[model samples]
Target: MESRRGQGSLEYLFMIAAALVIVLIVIRVLSGVSSNTPNQQVILYADPENFPTFNTSDNYFVYQTTVTKIGDDLYNVTFKAIAKRDLSHVKIRATLMCNKKPVYVGDQYLTVTDEVENLPKGWYISRYWSPIRRDEFPCEVVLYVWVG
Candidate 1:
């Protein structure tokens, strides 16, 4: 007995296969898809604003504030910050953010001594404050570090 698919059925099957291939191709083209590997990131910081959005994506620390002082008519914010890379050649700078502006407190150079450079290879100034202003009393000082 000779068994063969009818012409109509064979044509229908071929048509269905062609339609499936065409649909796949159209989907691929429309999606504009190409294989991309995900990048690995280290979560050095975890905060709401630090969640990869406002970041410039350059592995830099986002400027943050910690309300170090909440006085009667002032708020002193001390921001704890460090350089991203080890042995970072940095110039220490202080800024007091009171009314949405940065006021520089002069630049301080790092003088690495035997006790500082040899034992701990880190540069940090714990308390960097601006000089007292004559026109201000009980003023708020938002301490921040500027990496250069």
Candidate 2:
């Protein structure tokens, strides 16, 4: 009879241990602690394509990229362009692309408008967009430039 009592006590302890293990798993899941969590950090980058071709095709390059947080999940991005040859009436516009898709803030796409009438060779020009919402990490800036 004593052995039967001991067996019952051991079974009770095992059940309690199992319950604690289940509770721990539940807590972990509720806290959103996991290895598969996606990274939400944003990184701004410059596109290397050099779109809207200029006379000195190989001379245009994006020399710098800057990103600053303006609000929750919102950022301001700036890209600086370096000119290798004389450029005049330079008009530049930029679009924000996240994961190869354009990022929209409200109902419009995020963009920037900046122009330099005379950019001499070896000069740098910067264009920026403020309060751009980013839904994904590692976004790129695409620039469309015109020179007259």
Candidate 3:
């Protein structure tokens, strides 16, 4: 009789522990669901307002410039370069400006053709600048393109 009573009490405690675990799991799942709603979206990048959306030059055109935050103090700048004329080599120097002051400058050198000849007109290339450490937003980009 004493052994039977002890066994029943053990079973009761096991059931209560199981119930507590299930309740915790349900609460955690429900909390996760609420946190993932559309209103809680995260901003992956910074879109500067004063930056030029489309910029043109004699030898090339720069457009679709984007600044993305990669780390706490590092940011990346990317832009599309379209060749206005045929060229063998293209060099792009992009300067990130904040409040009329230069924050970071990056250079991208692209070989458009294998041979030492012109790549062709209207060819496009994407340039991703090295990461910079600038936390300010609403910045601008100054482009300098060289073709050979």
Candidate 4:
């Protein structure tokens, strides 16, 4: 009778221990899951090939290239000549190319009224790369300038 009672008590303890183990596993599985984490995703912008154009006719037909702001993806460049042919008595024309592709081709065949005479002519220009072709040729000429 004593041995039977001990066996019954042992079974009861084993059942309790099994239940406790299951409960612990359930708690661990539940706690391991997280709901507080965020969905981390970021989006960026795209860049165009051409936007700004520079014209410096006073500096020997040299057109300085404007810096572009590069963004995320692929792009097709666009060009519109902000014509500065009104600088001097010299007529000008420029052919713009990017990656060996012609973008903008412009010509100033007609000479505009000289306004450089109005401003005291001592090689007045704002650009650093611009050089004044002083006394080189005051008269007009058809120039095939390449701007890239």
Which candidate has the highest TM-score of all?
Answer: 2
- As a whole number from 0 to 100, the lDDT of residue 136 in candidate 2 is 51
What is candidate 4's lDDT per residue for 17-124, written digit by digit as tens?
999999999998875563222121111111122223333333333333332332332222222122343333322232222232221222231211212222223332
Q: Candidate 1 vs candidate 3: which has greater lDDT?
A: 3
Best lDDT among the predictions, by candidate number: 2
lDDT of 3 by residue, 1-148 (tens): 3544346788999999999999999999997775433221111222433442435444244345667667776666666656566767555454554432334542222112112235567766665544555644545555545455
Global lDDT of each model?
Answer: 0.35, 0.60, 0.51, 0.30
Clash totals in order: 0, 0, 0, 0
Sort every candidate by lDDT, greatest first: 2, 3, 1, 4
On a 0 to 1 TM-score scale, where does candidate 1 land against the true structure? 0.29
Q: What TM-score would each prediction reach against the true structure?
A: 0.29, 0.44, 0.38, 0.21
Model 2: per-residue Cα lDDT over 1-148, one tens digit each: 3544345788999999999999999999976653233222222363223321221233454355676776887766667778778888776666666653434443354666667889888888776655555555456766666655
Q: Over the stretch 1-148, how does candidate 1's per-residue lDDT look in tens digits?
A: 9999667988989999999999999998865542121122212221122221112122333333333223443333343333345533333233343322323333341111111221122333333333323223222323222222
Q: How displaced is residue 8 in candidate 2, in Å? A: 99
Error of 1 at 8 (Å): 83
